[model samples]
Target: MHRFVVIGGGAGGLELATRLGDAFGARRRNPQATVTLIDRNPTHIWKPLLHEVAAGSMDPYTHQLEYAAQAYWHGFEFQQGELTGIDRAAHTVTIAAVDDDTGREMLPSRSIRYDTLIIAIGSTTHFFNVPGADAHAFALDTVAEAERFRRRLIAACTRAESNDDALRAQGALPTHKRHRVQIAIVGGGATGVELSAELRNTAQVLSAYGLHGLDPRDDIGIVLIESGPRLLPALPERVSTETARLLEARAIDVRLGERVTEVAEHAVRTASGRDIPVDLTVWAAGIKAPRVLSTLDGLTVNGLGQLNVRPTLQTELDDDIFALGDCAACVWPTTGRNVPPRAQAAHQQAEFLFRAMRDRLSGRPLRAFEYRDLGSLVSLGHVTAVGNLMGGLIGGTMFIDGLFARIMYMSLYRMHIAALHGIPRMLLDTLAHWLRRRTVPRVKLH
Candidate 1:
């Protein structure tokens, strides 16, 4: 019997595990194989929508998948624990003990043996060791963190609204008569940029609902600070330029070429000595694979702490071991560039590995994974979206925006839903979610 273990139940890992389990798990009674999925969290939330979670535009609880329930219905064994180490010689992975929210021990450390192992633990925020950055800035890596940020944002606005005189005296007024709650966001990547835009929409929605006393238009100040010259540096220059223009038109302060040297309690200090007052500071700067990657029992890791893998998605040192998603540094064979860590990439890799696993079980030749550049999309809240889609006259990417781009952007999440829960569940859930949204507040206030 082959014991297949997949660690880290992120998008790629969860999908792969569900498919593999459905194929070989007890429902089918395939005595030749067993599948298990291990993750620290009891539920799974799509990483891409985290910014929406942080900005209170979306409630994560409504979208999260209960791993235990998913496993029961889909035929995979689910284990909850943090990955601590891997034993290459014995083909075993060690999971650290976990405690409940009250600090009571729930489970002890254990090791699981596997004939085949897939590691996709995902990445964490890389603070770059900036002074006070880790201590003062909020990183949206988990649901809890996102919810915390949302609460802080609301609290900041509420406090500012209640103390207009103090704000006016402190020169926190955006204009002659209104005070703005200044939010400092570090990094102009998709998370930072999207959150900035979403927050603007959140302010408007909050104000219209009378959730706060301040004027949304005049009381919310957004300062997006990017060390780079423009936003979404990973994307095309045109996209970045248009995005900047859109942000500026919405009264957002896009500060380019200003590196944050320190994140203080109430402000962010830039490289050029400019101090930006901040009611809330969010650090969406950069990411690195979890530090546990470095301790993964002789696995070779790149500078980003990602496991080095061949095009086959097999770890360089061990064929029995494989990796995918943000944790794997797999170079695109055609472009000689490492695959960019994107949700699209993760989704594609999951599909590729699903087929690869079946072949391995049948002792067939495994095909190498090829990454496709499907272009990128950036959503500007409910207003619009901008992105470049593949398929043009010369086979180059074509820039797109407005209503069409928004539809395309939405389709991405719909696709992820379809991948995870199948078309029927995805469709039903979509309708249910739409109905629920009409009855609830547009943004989460608590």
Candidate 2:
């Protein structure tokens, strides 16, 4: 049997591994391939929902899927380790040792040999070398990071209210004046925009829970700063305009064309010499492939540290090695640019690779990948979303918003679930989550 090793249990990686395992691994009557998935974390959560986690609108425990359970059900081996190095010549990948929370070793370092290797280790936040950014700002790259941000946000709100109460008692603050807790999000992309909207709702929920004394709308200030002239530059201008309008209506301060020069402990300094005071700061400016990609022996990575792959999703110099998702820089012939690093792009690439891998196993030719532009969507809280639907079916680009767009935005996550399990399980999971929501607080108070 051929050995298939996939590094990274991300959205694209997990989906591809599941498909391959179901089709060719031990689950099949006549197994042809032994599939293995390697990831640093023991569980998987959709990257798009990290913002919601940070805002405390979603309970991560309920949504996170255990990698070990997935592998058991799909007939694949799950390895919890970080990719340390790749040896293309030996066809072996080195995994670093894993440690428990108490610093005890859980798994020792080892190398896994593979007949075919797939690299899907996704991107990390790019701070662009801003002064103090790495030390002062938070990035929503993982569940742990998102949880940290949520805790900090809660603490900040509580501390601000406490300070105000003391000042009022001493007659230093007037009764009419409210203490402001400002949060600065350093990006106007989907993550920052969605997070800002979710935080607005979070403030309201926290007030309703009686966790803070300050008024939700009047005291909680969310500022979204973007260096670009408009938000969501990847989308059309109309969508950006509407998203900006919606956010501004919610009292979110949208600052466009202002580049961040420095991040202080309690403030963000802009290129225009504006110093915005903040209680908490989140960096969602951009993303680059993990630094480990650059250390890969003899792999040709692009400027973004992504492996450069051909149209067939194989590395330029190695036929046995393949890459997908945000970590792979694959060209789009239609625009003469690399495919956009979006979940939709990754899903399409994974589907393409599933068929390509089947052909490779059967000694057949692999076809080139053709990416279809499916447009984009940006969520504005739970009630509304803004995006354009593109394709021949829609007869070009049709803009949508409000509740209908919100439903469409949600269906994307459902589709990911259906890809892993079947449509039936996805439906059950949806119903279960909906029922659970009725019992839980709108935002995590603790």
User: Which candidate number has the best TM-score?
Assistant: 2
In Å, residue 6's CA in model 1 sits off its true spot by 0.7
> Top lDDT: which candidate number?
2
TM-score of each: 0.96, 0.98
What ranges in model 2 sit over 4 Å off? Answer: 174-179
TM-score of 2: 0.98
lDDT score, candidate 2, position 95: 97
Backbone clashes in model 1: 0
Q: What lDDT does the true structure give each of the candidates?
A: 0.90, 0.94
- State residue 33's C-alpha deviation in candidate 2, in Å: 0.5
lDDT of 1 by residue, 1-446 (tens): 78899999998999999888888886775545889999999999999999999989898989999999989988889999999998889988999899998999998999999999999999999999999999999999999999999999888888877777677789875554434688999999999999999999999888888778877867788989999989999999999999999999888999999999999999899999998888889999999999998887888999999999998899999999999999999998777889999998888898999899899999998999988888999999875999998743239889999888889898899888898889999999999999999999989978
lDDT of 1: 0.90
CA shift of 173, model 1, Å: 11
lDDT of 2 at 39: 98
lDDT of 2 by residue, 356-403 (tens): 889999999999999999888889999999999998548798999999
Residue 410's lDDT within candidate 2 is 98
